[model samples]
Target: MKKFLEVAEKLAHEKPLGPKYRNRRLVGNFKGRWECHIEPGWLLVYLKTDQEIIFERTGTHSDVFK
Candidate 1:
């Protein structure tokens, strides 16, 4: 949790980190949103706008996707 927050903070301040963070744009109904892996099944979903980064969800794969 601590490490995830640290990385999330960095992502919010800087440009997308890269593959290490598993940052990728979501498709389908989730189009326009982006996601980053925190662990094996844990993920953080969010949207990046011109003014701010909006976090939409954070949880395990099942929980987040559902």
Candidate 2:
């Protein structure tokens, strides 16, 4: 999960404005939250605020959705 953290850190700074995070998008039914693929089946979910990025969840697709 180290790589996931590194990518999440980079995303916290760059957000949707950067090409590296092109796949990031807002999640349905979860206001202020966004989702991004970390690997084939792993995902990293977070909520962005004016001051900081708050991590909400991370896991395989099925595990995270649960």
Candidate 3:
């Protein structure tokens, strides 16, 4: 299997869900125990195994958890 970060990168080539979340950070709602953060401001999304951005959203300045 691939890590979260890798998954985010593959999203484009494998299953790109672009524009759908441009300028907005949509939660992946990943059903796992790992913690991730969205970078809502660069049109790029990411997930992390520990603390690295896998996919980032480039827009809103709010915490999805908040």
Question: Best by TM-score, which number?
Answer: 1
TM-scores, each model vs. reference: 0.85, 0.72, 0.22
User: 1 or 3: which has the higher TM-score?
Assistant: 1
- TM value for model 1: 0.85
Ranking by TM-score: 1, 2, 3
Q: Give the clashing pairs for model 1.
A: none
Question: Candidate 1's residue-wise lDDT over 1-66, tens digit each?
Answer: 796887678877875566767889999989999899877678899998988888899988889998
Top of the candidates by lDDT? 1
Better of 1 and 3 by lDDT: 1
Q: What are the root-mean-square deviations of the candidates from the true structure over C-alphas?
A: 1.4, 2.6, 11.2
Clash count for each candidate, listed in order shown: 0, 0, 16
**CA lDDT of every candidate:** 0.84, 0.71, 0.38
**Candidate 2 vs candidate 3, lDDT winner:** 2
Candidate 2 residues 1-66, lDDT tens each? Answer: 787877777766774434544455665676568877777677777887778888888888788787
